[model samples]
Target: MEASGYLLSGVLTGLFLLGTVLVLARNRNWQHYSPAGDASGVGETVERLAGSPGTWIGGFVLLTLGLGLGTLVVVGGLPVPEGVQGAATVAMAVVVLAVLAGYVFLGVYHSVRYRGLYRSQAAAAGIWIVATLAVAGIAVMLLTAG
Candidate 1:
Protein backbone atom coordinates (compact mmCIF):
# COMPACT_ATOMS: atom_id res chain seq x y z
CA MET A 1 0.00 0.00 0.00
CA GLU A 2 2.75 2.41 0.89
CA ALA A 3 4.67 1.65 -2.27
CA SER A 4 1.54 2.03 -4.31
CA GLY A 5 1.07 5.53 -2.96
CA TYR A 6 4.58 6.45 -3.96
CA LEU A 7 4.04 5.01 -7.43
CA LEU A 8 0.83 6.93 -7.86
CA SER A 9 2.49 10.15 -6.80
CA GLY A 10 5.33 9.56 -9.19
CA VAL A 11 2.98 8.89 -12.07
CA LEU A 12 1.00 12.04 -11.40
CA THR A 13 4.15 14.11 -11.26
CA GLY A 14 5.40 12.56 -14.49
CA LEU A 15 2.18 13.39 -16.27
CA PHE A 16 2.35 16.97 -15.04
CA LEU A 17 5.88 17.37 -16.30
CA LEU A 18 4.95 15.86 -19.63
CA GLY A 19 2.12 18.31 -20.02
CA THR A 20 4.42 21.19 -19.12
CA VAL A 21 7.10 20.14 -21.57
CA LEU A 22 4.57 19.75 -24.34
CA VAL A 23 3.18 23.19 -23.74
CA LEU A 24 6.62 24.73 -23.57
CA ALA A 25 7.59 23.03 -26.80
CA ARG A 26 4.49 24.20 -28.57
CA ASN A 27 5.28 27.74 -27.45
CA ARG A 28 8.86 27.40 -28.67
CA ASN A 29 10.22 28.04 -25.25
CA TRP A 30 13.13 25.68 -25.83
CA GLN A 31 15.18 28.11 -27.83
CA HIS A 32 18.91 28.87 -28.05
CA TYR A 33 19.56 25.15 -28.30
CA SER A 34 22.72 23.93 -29.97
CA PRO A 35 23.16 20.23 -30.50
CA ALA A 36 26.79 20.89 -31.50
CA GLY A 37 27.71 24.45 -30.78
CA ASP A 38 30.45 25.95 -28.61
CA ALA A 39 28.92 29.31 -27.74
CA SER A 40 27.18 28.53 -24.46
CA GLY A 41 30.27 29.42 -22.42
CA VAL A 42 29.26 26.74 -19.93
CA GLY A 43 32.28 24.70 -20.83
CA GLU A 44 34.47 27.68 -20.16
CA THR A 45 32.70 28.23 -16.88
CA VAL A 46 33.50 24.68 -15.76
CA GLU A 47 37.01 24.88 -17.14
CA ARG A 48 37.59 28.16 -15.38
CA LEU A 49 36.43 26.74 -12.08
CA ALA A 50 38.35 23.50 -12.49
CA GLY A 51 41.63 25.10 -13.44
CA SER A 52 41.82 27.06 -10.19
CA PRO A 53 43.89 25.68 -7.36
CA GLY A 54 42.16 23.85 -4.47
CA THR A 55 39.02 23.12 -6.49
CA TRP A 56 39.36 19.36 -6.49
CA ILE A 57 41.62 19.36 -3.48
CA GLY A 58 39.11 21.17 -1.25
CA GLY A 59 36.28 18.88 -2.34
CA PHE A 60 38.31 15.77 -1.59
CA VAL A 61 39.38 17.12 1.77
CA LEU A 62 35.75 17.65 2.77
CA LEU A 63 34.81 14.24 1.46
CA THR A 64 37.59 12.58 3.43
CA LEU A 65 36.63 14.38 6.62
CA GLY A 66 32.98 13.41 6.22
CA LEU A 67 33.85 9.78 5.56
CA GLY A 68 36.21 9.64 8.51
CA LEU A 69 33.62 11.09 10.87
CA GLY A 70 30.93 8.79 9.54
CA THR A 71 33.17 5.79 10.03
CA LEU A 72 33.98 6.87 13.55
CA VAL A 73 30.29 7.23 14.38
CA VAL A 74 29.16 3.95 12.84
CA VAL A 75 32.11 1.63 13.42
CA GLY A 76 33.65 3.14 16.50
CA GLY A 77 30.27 3.99 18.04
CA LEU A 78 31.36 7.43 19.14
CA PRO A 79 28.91 8.98 21.57
CA VAL A 80 27.27 12.17 20.43
CA PRO A 81 26.65 14.93 22.90
CA GLU A 82 23.27 15.46 24.56
CA GLY A 83 21.95 17.94 22.02
CA VAL A 84 22.74 18.58 18.36
CA GLN A 85 23.26 14.88 17.64
CA GLY A 86 21.38 15.35 14.37
CA ALA A 87 23.36 18.49 13.48
CA ALA A 88 25.76 16.54 11.30
CA THR A 89 22.97 15.06 9.22
CA VAL A 90 21.30 18.44 8.82
CA ALA A 91 24.60 20.08 7.93
CA MET A 92 25.30 17.38 5.37
CA ALA A 93 21.90 17.90 3.80
CA VAL A 94 22.49 21.67 3.58
CA VAL A 95 25.88 21.06 1.99
CA VAL A 96 24.36 18.72 -0.54
CA LEU A 97 21.65 21.23 -1.43
CA ALA A 98 24.17 24.05 -1.70
CA VAL A 99 26.33 22.05 -4.08
CA LEU A 100 23.35 21.02 -6.16
CA ALA A 101 22.13 24.61 -6.40
CA GLY A 102 25.54 25.84 -7.46
CA TYR A 103 25.82 23.22 -10.17
CA VAL A 104 22.36 23.93 -11.50
CA PHE A 105 22.97 27.65 -11.43
CA LEU A 106 26.15 27.15 -13.40
CA GLY A 107 24.19 25.62 -16.27
CA VAL A 108 21.88 28.66 -16.53
CA TYR A 109 23.56 31.64 -14.93
CA HIS A 110 25.24 32.67 -18.18
CA SER A 111 21.95 33.72 -19.72
CA VAL A 112 22.13 37.14 -18.15
CA ARG A 113 25.88 37.62 -18.22
CA TYR A 114 27.03 35.90 -21.41
CA ARG A 115 25.99 35.21 -24.98
CA GLY A 116 24.60 32.02 -26.58
CA LEU A 117 21.90 31.77 -23.93
CA TYR A 118 18.51 33.32 -23.29
CA ARG A 119 15.19 32.43 -21.77
CA SER A 120 15.63 28.87 -22.96
CA GLN A 121 18.43 28.23 -20.50
CA ALA A 122 16.42 29.70 -17.67
CA ALA A 123 13.30 27.80 -18.75
CA ALA A 124 15.20 24.53 -18.75
CA ALA A 125 16.53 25.30 -15.30
CA GLY A 126 13.04 26.13 -14.09
CA ILE A 127 11.70 22.82 -15.32
CA TRP A 128 14.47 20.88 -13.62
CA ILE A 129 13.97 22.77 -10.38
CA VAL A 130 10.27 21.97 -10.41
CA ALA A 131 10.83 18.30 -11.09
CA THR A 132 13.45 18.03 -8.37
CA LEU A 133 11.21 19.82 -5.92
CA ALA A 134 8.39 17.42 -6.67
CA VAL A 135 10.59 14.40 -6.13
CA ALA A 136 12.02 15.84 -2.94
CA GLY A 137 8.56 16.57 -1.64
CA ILE A 138 7.46 12.99 -2.24
CA ALA A 139 10.61 11.62 -0.67
CA VAL A 140 10.08 13.78 2.37
CA MET A 141 6.53 12.54 2.64
CA LEU A 142 7.65 8.93 2.52
CA LEU A 143 10.52 9.41 4.94
CA THR A 144 8.40 11.25 7.46
CA ALA A 145 5.53 8.82 7.37
CA GLY A 146 4.78 7.37 10.78
Candidate 2:
Protein backbone atom coordinates (compact mmCIF):
# COMPACT_ATOMS: atom_id res chain seq x y z
CA MET A 1 0.00 0.00 0.00
CA GLU A 2 2.74 2.42 0.88
CA ALA A 3 4.63 1.68 -2.29
CA SER A 4 1.50 2.12 -4.37
CA GLY A 5 0.77 5.40 -2.67
CA TYR A 6 4.24 6.71 -3.33
CA LEU A 7 4.03 5.65 -6.94
CA LEU A 8 0.64 7.28 -7.36
CA SER A 9 1.86 10.47 -5.77
CA GLY A 10 4.83 10.62 -8.10
CA VAL A 11 2.74 9.94 -11.16
CA LEU A 12 0.07 12.41 -10.16
CA THR A 13 2.61 15.10 -9.41
CA GLY A 14 4.26 14.59 -12.77
CA LEU A 15 0.94 14.77 -14.58
CA PHE A 16 -0.12 17.89 -12.72
CA LEU A 17 3.19 19.57 -13.46
CA LEU A 18 3.01 18.58 -17.10
CA GLY A 19 -0.53 19.88 -17.37
CA THR A 20 0.46 23.15 -15.78
CA VAL A 21 3.31 23.57 -18.22
CA LEU A 22 1.13 22.77 -21.20
CA VAL A 23 -1.49 25.24 -20.08
CA LEU A 24 1.15 27.93 -19.75
CA ALA A 25 2.49 27.09 -23.15
CA ARG A 26 -0.98 27.33 -24.62
CA ASN A 27 -1.40 30.75 -23.05
CA ARG A 28 1.84 31.86 -24.58
CA ASN A 29 0.76 30.60 -27.97
CA TRP A 30 -2.50 32.48 -27.59
CA GLN A 31 -0.64 35.65 -26.79
CA HIS A 32 1.47 35.23 -29.89
CA TYR A 33 -1.57 34.44 -32.02
CA SER A 34 -3.44 37.47 -30.77
CA PRO A 35 -0.75 40.11 -30.58
CA ALA A 36 -3.33 42.86 -30.94
CA GLY A 37 -5.01 42.76 -27.53
CA ASP A 38 -6.32 40.59 -24.72
CA ALA A 39 -9.47 38.50 -24.88
CA SER A 40 -12.69 40.54 -24.78
CA GLY A 41 -14.19 39.12 -21.61
CA VAL A 42 -14.37 36.14 -19.30
CA GLY A 43 -16.44 34.31 -21.86
CA GLU A 44 -13.99 34.80 -24.68
CA THR A 45 -11.07 33.92 -22.47
CA VAL A 46 -12.67 30.75 -21.17
CA GLU A 47 -13.80 29.82 -24.66
CA ARG A 48 -10.32 30.14 -26.06
CA LEU A 49 -8.70 28.26 -23.19
CA ALA A 50 -11.31 25.53 -23.13
CA GLY A 51 -11.16 25.11 -26.89
CA SER A 52 -7.52 24.13 -26.69
CA PRO A 53 -6.55 20.46 -26.50
CA GLY A 54 -4.01 21.33 -23.86
CA THR A 55 -6.63 22.81 -21.56
CA TRP A 56 -8.86 19.75 -21.82
CA ILE A 57 -5.96 17.43 -21.17
CA GLY A 58 -4.80 19.57 -18.30
CA GLY A 59 -8.24 19.49 -16.73
CA PHE A 60 -8.22 15.71 -16.82
CA VAL A 61 -4.76 15.61 -15.29
CA LEU A 62 -5.91 17.79 -12.41
CA LEU A 63 -8.98 15.66 -11.86
CA THR A 64 -6.87 12.54 -11.80
CA LEU A 65 -4.44 14.07 -9.36
CA GLY A 66 -7.23 15.01 -6.96
CA LEU A 67 -8.82 11.59 -7.16
CA GLY A 68 -5.52 9.78 -6.76
CA LEU A 69 -4.51 11.87 -3.78
CA GLY A 70 -7.83 11.24 -2.10
CA THR A 71 -7.50 7.53 -2.70
CA LEU A 72 -4.00 7.53 -1.26
CA VAL A 73 -5.20 9.28 1.83
CA VAL A 74 -8.14 6.95 2.30
CA VAL A 75 -5.97 3.89 1.78
CA GLY A 76 -3.59 5.09 4.45
CA GLY A 77 -0.76 4.97 1.99
CA LEU A 78 0.33 8.57 1.95
CA PRO A 79 3.78 8.94 3.39
CA VAL A 80 3.16 12.04 5.37
CA PRO A 81 5.33 12.68 8.40
CA GLU A 82 3.90 10.91 11.38
CA GLY A 83 4.00 13.96 13.58
CA VAL A 84 2.38 16.23 11.00
CA GLN A 85 -0.15 13.92 9.45
CA GLY A 86 -3.16 16.00 10.49
CA ALA A 87 -1.65 19.22 9.23
CA ALA A 88 -0.65 17.55 5.98
CA THR A 89 -4.11 16.16 5.47
CA VAL A 90 -5.71 19.54 6.06
CA ALA A 91 -3.32 21.21 3.68
CA MET A 92 -4.08 18.68 0.97
CA ALA A 93 -7.80 19.14 1.51
CA VAL A 94 -7.41 22.89 1.20
CA VAL A 95 -5.53 22.51 -2.07
CA VAL A 96 -8.25 20.28 -3.51
CA LEU A 97 -10.96 22.74 -2.43
CA ALA A 98 -9.08 25.62 -4.01
CA VAL A 99 -8.89 23.78 -7.33
CA LEU A 100 -12.65 23.16 -7.18
CA ALA A 101 -13.31 26.81 -6.41
CA GLY A 102 -11.19 27.85 -9.37
CA TYR A 103 -13.24 25.68 -11.70
CA VAL A 104 -16.55 27.07 -10.44
CA PHE A 105 -15.29 30.61 -10.66
CA LEU A 106 -14.17 30.11 -14.23
CA GLY A 107 -17.47 28.58 -15.26
CA VAL A 108 -19.64 31.18 -13.56
CA TYR A 109 -17.56 34.08 -14.79
CA HIS A 110 -17.71 32.86 -18.35
CA SER A 111 -21.42 32.14 -18.21
CA VAL A 112 -22.19 35.53 -16.74
CA ARG A 113 -19.87 37.40 -19.06
CA TYR A 114 -21.05 35.70 -22.22
CA ARG A 115 -24.53 34.36 -21.78
CA GLY A 116 -24.68 33.45 -25.44
CA LEU A 117 -21.28 31.80 -25.66
CA TYR A 118 -21.56 29.71 -22.54
CA ARG A 119 -21.23 26.47 -24.38
CA SER A 120 -18.70 24.26 -22.55
CA GLN A 121 -18.78 26.01 -19.20
CA ALA A 122 -21.40 23.68 -17.82
CA ALA A 123 -19.48 20.59 -18.85
CA ALA A 124 -16.27 21.89 -17.40
CA ALA A 125 -17.97 22.88 -14.19
CA GLY A 126 -19.71 19.50 -13.92
CA ILE A 127 -16.46 17.58 -14.25
CA TRP A 128 -14.76 19.79 -11.72
CA ILE A 129 -17.60 19.43 -9.24
CA VAL A 130 -17.70 15.67 -9.57
CA ALA A 131 -13.97 15.26 -9.22
CA THR A 132 -13.80 17.65 -6.30
CA LEU A 133 -16.64 15.91 -4.51
CA ALA A 134 -15.08 12.52 -5.02
CA VAL A 135 -11.83 13.73 -3.55
CA ALA A 136 -13.60 15.43 -0.65
CA GLY A 137 -15.60 12.32 0.13
CA ILE A 138 -12.49 10.17 0.15
CA ALA A 139 -10.64 12.63 2.31
CA VAL A 140 -13.54 12.65 4.78
CA MET A 141 -13.47 8.88 4.91
CA LEU A 142 -9.75 8.95 5.54
CA LEU A 143 -10.19 11.36 8.42
CA THR A 144 -12.97 9.36 10.00
CA ALA A 145 -11.42 5.98 9.39
CA GLY A 146 -8.77 6.68 11.96
- lDDT, candidates in the order shown: 0.69, 0.67
User: Candidate 1: where are CA atoms >4 Å away?
Assistant: 1-14, 29-49, 70-79, 93-130, 133-140, 143-146
Show model 2 residue runs off by greater than 4 Å.
1-51, 115-146
Candidate 1, residue 124: the lDDT equals: 65
1-146: candidate 2 lDDT, tens digit per residue: 87568558857986896798678757743322225655568878888998999998998898778767765765579776655556556767777777777767666656654765344545555565566567667766765664
TM-score of 1: 0.46
Question: Against the true structure, candidate 2 has what lDDT?
Answer: 0.67
Candidate 1 local Cα displacement, residue 115, angstroms: 18
Per residue, candidate 1 scores C-alpha lDDT tens digits across 26-121 of 895433545676688999899988997789899879877885685555443688763444666566666666666766666555543365556666
> Residue 112 deviation, candidate 1, in Å?
20
Give Cα distance to truth, residue 68, candidate 1, Å.
2.0
**Residue 32 of model 2: what lDDT?**
20
